[model samples]
Structure formats: structure tokens, C-alpha cells
Target: MTADCKGTVRNLDRNEAAGASLQASGQRDQVISFRIEHTDEHGDVTGYSQVELRGEVIYGGLTDGDRVEISGRKGGDGILRPSRAKNLSTDSEIWVSNRPGVKILQGIITVIMLLAFLTAAFFMITGISGGRFP
Candidate 1:
């Protein structure tokens, strides 16, 4: 079975840090660091794992206790190859918004209901005029 590991970006080199450093002094800035805690299935502490992700102003800054999900397979070197990393914050918002189409769907449903009602009323009137019902 593939084992899943969770960790956070300890060192983040982003544009924001450069800008901050430039605005403050002429010295290069340090990368952002995060402390991540992970555990194994047996409830054993997996120790502190760190990752350095390079980007423009870390998309979602990792906090001290941010929840993360990692999926990967254990390699022969006793290390995990993380194939996927997900942050709780961005994951929730990564969904298709159906709000824009809701009005269109509502209108279609209303038209269908009106047509059904009219058809029923027409059938009742025809039945009454043709003496099909007493």
C-alpha cells in the first residue's frame, strides 16, 4: 500500500520576500519557514519535515498548524515520493461554481411546469366538451 506523508513548505522563496528586503535594506531576505508535524499510521511522530517551494509569494502561506494532505509511494531508499500536495485553504475553493447557471436552470424548470399545467387544463376542457366525463 502507498503511504501518505504530510509536510509544509519550510523555506519559501517568493517575490514578496525580495520586495520586503529591497524596501527595508539592500541585503537579501531569508526564505519563509514553516514547522510541520506529521505522524504515521501507528501514531508515531514522523518528526519535522521541511520542503522549500519556490514561487511568487507563496500561494497560501503555511502556518504553524496548517493541515496538509500528501499522497505518494515509499521508495526503496525509505523515502516517500510525494505526488500530490494539498493545502486545506485552497482545496475548498477549488470547486466549480454553479451559481451562474442556477438562474438558467430555474427558468427551464418554470417553463416545463407551465407547459405541463397548460396541457392538463386543455385535456380537462376537451374532455368536458366531448362528454368523455360526466
Candidate 2:
């Protein structure tokens, strides 16, 4: 049967730098599991749950304390077999997880911070910047 859950990553089921699975022959594939606090449809946290997610989830940058939604199925052995995952935080929130490559906004932020700092420095040198130090 398929199952779904939404919640924060409480912790890794065990200690390891990361996880991986071996493909046919000798190729390696990474696997990660997270214990979570399941939430209801209205967003109220319902209870605890666990999932074993496969693949490098696109837009799925997972980290501890991150809230996520997962979809998968339960095996006959009672283990949760997750096939997909997604992050559910907003733009204003700290994205603990991202697809990869630092973050989607990293480049944008570089330009923004550079411009802000340069503008502030320019105004400071010219005594046109707003603040209490003038």
C-alpha cells in the first residue's frame, strides 16, 4: 500500500557520513533515511514516521530540521519504501535542503550582496549613506 508523510527530519536512523546502495555489478547509488514527525492535511503534526528515499531528489536537498513531504509504499515486511520526496518550505525560510550546486539562489545572492556592500561602501566614503555613524 502507498503511504505519505509530511514533517521534519528528526534524525538519521543511525550514524554515518551519508548512505549509498550498490547497483548491478559495482556501481554505487546513495540512499538516505530520515525519521520524521508526520503532519495532517491541515499541517498539524500528527505523529512520527520514517522513510527510505531513493535517488537524488530534484529540488530535494534534504538536511536535518527540514520539513518535507514523502510518497512511497509499505513493503510486506512493514518497511516504508519511499519513491519520491519534496521540500515544503517557502522562499522566506532557510532552505536546509536544495537540489545541489550550493543553491538555486546562490548566484543571485552573490550579486545582491555584492551590490549592497558596494553601495554601502560608496555612500560611506561620500558620507551619503544613512545610518547613525554619519
Report the lDDT tens digits of candidate 2 across residue range 1-95. Answer: 88776688877542322445533324343456678887777988788876665443323456777877767787786657665566665322211
Ten residues in a row with the worst lDDT in model 1?
Answer: 91-100
Model 1 TM-score is: 0.33
**TM-score for all predictions?**
0.33, 0.48
| Residues 6-66 of candidate 1: C-alpha lDDT, one tens digit per residue | 6543333333344433312233433343434676778677786543332222233344455
The Cα local distance difference test for each model comes to 0.49, 0.61
Candidate 1 displacement at residue 26 in angstroms: 11
- The Cα error of candidate 2 at residue 106, in Å, is 37
Return the TM-score for candidate 2, rounded to 2 decimals: 0.48
